[model samples]
Every structure is written in C-alpha cells, then in structure tokens.
Target: MRALPLSSGSVLIDLHTSWNSANEIPISTTLAYFSSSFRQTRRGRKGIASSSTPLSSSSSFHSNSSSIRKPSDRFSNGSLVSSSTPLLSLSTSRELELFLELVPLRMRNELLKHDELRTLIEVVIDLGRKPIARFPTGDWVISDETVKLEDLHHAISKVGEFSDDNRSGIDHSLHRISAIRNRKMQIIGLTCRFGRAISGNAEMIRDLVEGGGSILVIGRPGVGKTTLIREMARMLADDHLRRVVIVDTSNEIGGDGDIPHSGIGRARRMQVPNVNLQHNVMIEAVENHMPETIIIDEIGTELEALAASTIAQRGVQLVGTAHGMTIDNIIKNPSLQILVGGIESVTLGDEEARKRKVQKTILERKGPPAFTCAIEMISKTEYRVHHRLDATVDAILAGKLPRFEVRRVEEKANDSVTTIVEPEKHSLHESEVTEKEYNTTQIEPTEDFIEYPVRRMIKRSNTKPSSTRTLPVCVYTYKILEADLLQVAEVMGLENDLNVTDDIGTADVILASSSELKQNRWIRSVAKFHKLSIFVIKVI
Candidate 1:
C-alpha cells in the first residue's frame, strides 16, 4: 500500500495492491496522476477528487480516496457541530492498518502500568468498533496492522473520559467489543494437541464443552491454568458461538486497557476494576444478563461460592479457577465445596478385565452407568480412572447406591464412610460449670444414638461480635417462651477451636426466639448457616 499526495492541492489518495509484484510499479506511477486531477477543482481549504476511472474495473491495482475534508471543516456544519466523525473512517481496512503504527510504544507501556490494566483494556475494547479474530492458543490477536489509529484514539478517549452517568456508554461499547483477530483462516496452522490440558486437574476443553460440564479448574501457580482457560474460552466462543462472559479479575486473559492484547475468541467480557466486587458482579450477570455461561478467574472467597451456586441454580453454566493440586484439596475447602461436586476415589483397572466387568455391571444395574473415564491432571501430567466400583461404593455409603452393591464392596464402603464421621469428643471438667448452672444436666438415649445437653456459665462481658469466635452458650426467647440451645452450643464449640458457624457477621449462632420461629424463612436461614450438630429444642 502507498499513499500519494496530489500535486495541485493537499488531497491524498491511497492505493491498495492485493498481490505484491514488480509489475505493480507502473500502477503506483499512474496513481500519482489520478491524485492531481482530484485536487484541481477544489477551492480554499477544501479538497475534492475527480477520478479518471471508477473503482469497478479489474485493474492490477485499485485506487480510492475521499475528498480531502479538514477536521475543522468536517466538524463545522449548520448546527454549530457536524455529525461527521473526524476519526478515521472504516471505509478502507488499510487506513486502520497505517493508524495503528502511529501509536507511540511509550504510551502503550504507560497504559500497562495502571493498577487495573484489565478493566482499562475492557473499556478500550468496548470502544473499538471492529471485530476481533480468534487464534488457536486462545489468546485474541489484533494485527495493529489492520486497525486504524483514529478509531483507536476515539475508543481510548471514550474509555478515559467516562463518568458514572456515562456507564451506559461503557456497557454499550463492551457488548459490541470483541477480543479476537478477525480472519478467514487460522492464524497459526499447527494442530492443537489437546490431551495435555488436563495436567492442571482440568478435564479436556472439548469434554467440558461437549458434555456441558461446568468446570472448576484448580492448580498450583505456574501450571498454565490461565493459558488453558484463555484457549478454552476462545475455542468455545469462536468455534461454537457459545455466549461466554468472562469476569477477568487481573486482565491476564486479555491484557491492559481496552483492546484485548491476548486472544480469547469473540466472547464479550466484563472486567471488574477491583477484586472486591467480583463475587457480586458474577451474581448480577446471571440474574440480569441472559448469559449461557459465566467464567471467572481465581475464586477467592466463601461469598464467591455462594454467588456461583446462585448462578448455577439459574441453569447458567460456570467455569472458574482456584489454587490447589488435587481434587481432594478442593473438596475439603468449605468455600470450594459449594461450587464443586466431589470426585469419587479413582482406581484404574486393566483394560481387558475392567472393560468386561464394566460392560456387564452397566447392563445389570439398569440405570445409566456413572462416568468411569480416566481423568488426567494437567499440572502433574498423571492419569487415574474414575471407576464404576469406586463410584458405586461411594454412592452406597452415602445412601445413594443400593444395598446390594454395598455388600459387594464391603471394605471399600467402610473405608469411604470413615472419612465422613464426626470427630470424638474429649471429656469436660466438672469445675468448668459454675455453681448456679450445676443443676442443668440432661442426657437421653434414643434407639439410634445418645444425645447430651449440658450447661456452663463462667463470666460476663460486653465485647464486639466476631464471626470467627464461636459462642459456647446460647439461649433463645421469643413470644415470652424460652428454649434451651445446648446443641447450638456444641456445634459452635469455641472450646474446640474449629470454624463451625458459616456467618461472617456474628459469633453466636442463635436461632430465632419463639416470636421469630414462626417466620419460617428466618429460622431456616439461621440453621443452614450454622450447621448445628444435633436436635434443635422446641419450646412453646
């Protein structure tokens, strides 16, 4: 491509050549003459073009130029301001190509230094009115060669100048912004070896998409979890047109300030400015925006898990990452457990015997056999099979699988249930009980087990409430009725130093008093949050 300045005036004409060859040299000389005639008829600061030939011919190279209208001229119409955008037009793709080269490298670095590069980039991309192209590695690629600087400047101006009331403009730009390199063919032509993405404790990207599996990816640092997630989003969104909305917490997926420097397909995304409101943004997207799927980076808190569950409840699929090396580590976490379904113990069997037995057992059970495929972790590059036997044993012990299978896997069933039992209690000293509370000792033996109700009182104080500190004694009074709450006391066993209550606001896990127990929603909310160990006393 070459730009020719007309001799008679300031008019410039751009010529584009699809093929690069020596024969195109004559066309460049011919383009210079065309530029002169285009400039001769114009007067004052305005410039016009008179084409010797229209652009509809099958010439070796085609020439096109707009009437050279100055920025002030375009902006000066009868209304005091003109509607013509002074920014570079998308009339020719090559103008975008030249404008990107004008961006100073130093300005780009200054942008990268912002504390919230991700959110800034989201804003920039939202303002960029061009479609993006997807590469196989899952990062978005912009040729910079194909984008005009004027268009980019307008987008950057929009992002940097936004105010609270103009947030609607931001939203509008974000929905239209894309994060992929737009092309008719793959930018990189190498075949993707996909079996390895599981090393970081993730299933294959293809499996998650095809099976509609909502994945919770976990990995130790430096394990390529982010890389996998980027590629996964791009493939699913560009290839399948799955409506994937990502909450890029750190901008690692797309990079700094508006145009996605990384490829993530054509998916639309929201970048949370600070990490504080991530859990909240995800919930809002699911509730208000009709997203088919939601993706978040590094789930960090209990509140996030609660929000993810709410989205899943609405049937919107979720994909997120966390820090861990194994499935067991995730399951053991109170916050992580909410988003993740448990992985049954996996024991790989030899193909010949295992396949035969699996086929026979699946036929006999008469229900769809549980997933028994081998699961591989991407970080360690190791493999293990999720077997029918292990799943059956897990289900049977949990009252999900039937009794007939329980008998077949006696040892396995016993081992699995051992992981679920409540811990044993140590003896409490009698001196711990105060003189005024010594008479309140109650014990009962039901057919299945024993229950204990004991009371202790030692001190009185006025202190600010703490969620981390479990209360030793609780009493409920409502509608002038009193109920003993020894079970709540045992569950919130501050004496044992375990984090028992789920509330982040209060130390005491008190149920509603008789006056409030009639409010069924209030009662259930308390019980669910506290997870008390035994029966809740009822008083009238």
Candidate 2:
C-alpha cells in the first residue's frame, strides 16, 4: 500500500496491493479519496474526513509557507465579542498516519474497510470480543474478527514499552495505547486514544494566565484538559517568554521519548520515570529549574496537592488539572480539597454563632488555597470561571451559591473563531438549583401557587452538606399552609431536611404569598435584615 499525493489538493491511498504477507488484497481494495464530508477548514488547520468505504480513518491535511505556528490571539474581555481570530499555531493530522500505520495490515484492509468512522476518539480491542471504534458522535463495530494474540503482538511491538501504568505511545505522535490485564496479569485488551494539540484553545483564559496566580482546572476526563495545558505551556514559553516546565506523566501531555513534542514549544519538560514519583518531580522542578510557571497535567494525589501548595508558596504560577466536573468536587474531595482551601468545622462562640445566624459549628476555609482561581470546564466552547477561590468556598459554606461567569466560544467554517463572555449572574434559577444542588435524585414539582426554595440552611440539622445526604432547611410559612409544603417534602424524601417553623427569627428562608408579603412590612424588613431568601407563593 502506498499514499499518492495528487496535484489537485487530494491524496489517493493505494490499497490494491497486499499489506499482509504479500497476498493479493480482496476485490474490496479500491482507491480512497477525501470525501465531501471531510471538511477542510484552513491551510494549517486539521479537518475530519470519511470515505464511502472506510480506510480505517482519513483526515484532510493542508499546509503552506503562510501556515506557520504563530502566537495565539485572544478576544478582548467583554459581554460579547465576534472578533475574527487569526490563524493560530498551525495544527495538522499529518502525524495521524503514524497511528494508522500501526494497525495490523490484514485487519486494516479487510476488517475496518466498510464502516464509516469520523471525528475518531479511541479504538477498543478485547481478546474475545469484536473490535470497536469510538468517536465523538457514537461507537461502531469496525470488524467482525475477534481480537487475537497475533493482533495484540503486532501493536505491542510497534509502540513504546508499556509503563507500570499499562500505557505506551508512539515516540513522536500523540496516539496513546493503554493495556488491560486479566486476573492472571496477562494482557487481554488495548485502548488506543488519539491525541491532538489545539492552538488558541486557551486564548479565552489569557487574562487568567497573565494574572500570575495559580489556576486549577477541574473537569471530567477526555474533555481536552491535556490539550489545553499543552497550549498553555507553549503560550507561556514561546509567546509570553515565561519559563515553563511540564511534569508530563505517561507522556500524555508532551508525547513519548526523551525529546518532548513541539506542541509545548520551548517549555522544558521533565518526564516522570514513574507515576508515583510525580510529586517528587514536581518539587524538583521548582527547587532546581526555577521555572516561572509549572504545568501539571493531573493532580490526583494528596501528596501532589501538597506539592502544588508548596509550589504556590514559592511564588511560581501553577497551572494544573484535576478530575472533577466542578470546583465543588475539589472542595468535597478529601485528597483534592487541599487544592482549593481545605475545609474545617469550626465551633463559633455564642455571640459569633448568633451574629452569623447559624449553629455554633460550621465549615470554613482552613487557609488560602493553592490555586487562586478555579475553572470548571463545561465543554470545549463553554467554561465556568471562579476568579476567587477563597470567596467561592466561603459562599458554599454559608449555604449561598456563588455567582457564575461563563465564556462561550464558536468556530466558523471559514477558519475564524468567535468568543463571547456572557454577563455574570449572582442568583440561580429555581430549576437550575433543583437539578444541580446536593445530587438529590428527586425534584420538588414546580407549582403555580407554591414557589420552590433553593438550598437553604436548615437550623435543625448539624451535619455538613454532602452529596449523599440532604441538608435540612427551616421554612417559616406565612398564610401558606405548612401541611401542604410538609407533605410535598415527605413525598420527595426531604422530610428530615424540610421543616415548618413558626418563629421567623430561627428560619433560614421565608415562604409567603405576594399579596400577604405586601401587607406584612415587618416580615419583609426582618428578612432583609437577616439576608434570608424569600419565595413568593400564590393563594390556591
């Protein structure tokens, strides 16, 4: 098999020849070209492609003298900005061919020839099951042939040695191959993940990087966290001229081999010989190299979190990622909570507790967090930014939700990227709070006559708010029947948390009709004085 690059801006892949043991390929071996579905964005950009008959996977790669890596462009901070983003550091899937080259020729030519796989994410192969291909849209059964020992051997031979973590990769490419072992400790499966370096992806948070404060990014796995930090390292090293060092574990961030990939630009990389020694290497990066910025891919350990705090104390900007959908995840995680400020239950004095309008004991920040700012990645195009970690943590402890600032990004087919910074909102809607708060499985049905209250501090319960258990809330209902609301709470399994209180002084929240609330000026004044949340209900 040979790749023929034609002058008409298309490459013809010659699959007619035998790729396995010199045997003539079957009649299905036909020439493949870039399909119309294959979108070619710009001269330097990479585009996803598919064929009528799958040649495993195909991509559109175009390059020219103008398509060189340039400094990433950032949109000016605003409510909305449609500024056309310039061609950032050029990216291409030219190296993707290396991943394709690893497939056992027999499997590639015969097995994956008919299925259409686009926007490829990963490929899974198990010993007894048929090989499966996964992409962003969905998954597909790429081959009828069950993975055999010979096929696994073909892959293991082509890649780097699998580490203690059961992960290996191509020396220069971003493709990672991870192994699965049975109870006997024998390899039985392999998951191959394709990695790409996206330029200008971090441009949305340019101001955060320039602030010179430690920033911790929290998100679910495979949300492009590694790719984001790779660009950040490059921007800090090549664009801003800051000394940046990356603690690349498993070669996911910097690729494999002694030499790091160009994706990180001039930033120096310290490869961890072993995953367990990552924390030690993190400290070593600061004590020895004197880097201005240290980029860590995943801070999954308490020791690593401690190391991060130590790094922050030394005045080095720390940019790292941890596994979590929200900063609250980091706050609740015993090991990772230290990354944000550690939580402590403090018993307040009589006057202090009464003045705060709460029980004697409450959760408080132990100290300044390692990271000054935390970013919750909603998606590649959207992000929830928490500028002040200390303030955000304090608000959560006080049973008040912190304000949210969101950033939205949209890329045009014409190669221009647009970014919009939505206006910040301090209050969350009733439905938003119901779905998001406390991991409660049941939602109180919205009623026209009754307004559902958000999470409020219940004076009855002393236990801390947790995802597993609900925090009881004290509600002082004026004119609205307490029995009706109490019945609703019982059905939703919030009976223990929801209680009716006659004394307005002890209530965390007030529920009353709009007409009644107007008649009772004293109640309104007291609620304002206590800074309590008010829910308006209508007469049934």
lDDT of each: 0.39, 0.68
Q: Give per-residue CA lDDT, model 2, range 156-242, as digits (tens).
A: 777889898899998766778999999998889999887777778989988888888888888898888888889988988998899
* Per-prediction TM-score: 0.33, 0.66
Q: Over 4 Å off in model 2, which ranges?
A: 1-91, 110-118, 413-540
Candidate 1 at 396: error in angstroms? Answer: 14
lDDT of 2 at 283: 98
Tens digits of per-residue lDDT, candidate 1, 411-529, equal 24545321212212222221122222222111111122112222212112123236765443343322322222334434444333322333323324333333244333233323332
Which window of 10 residues has the lowest lDDT sum in candidate 2? 73-82
**Candidate 1: where is the Cα deviation over 4 Å?**
1-204, 341-376, 380-540
Q: Give the clashing residue pairs of candidate 2, or none.
A: 472-497
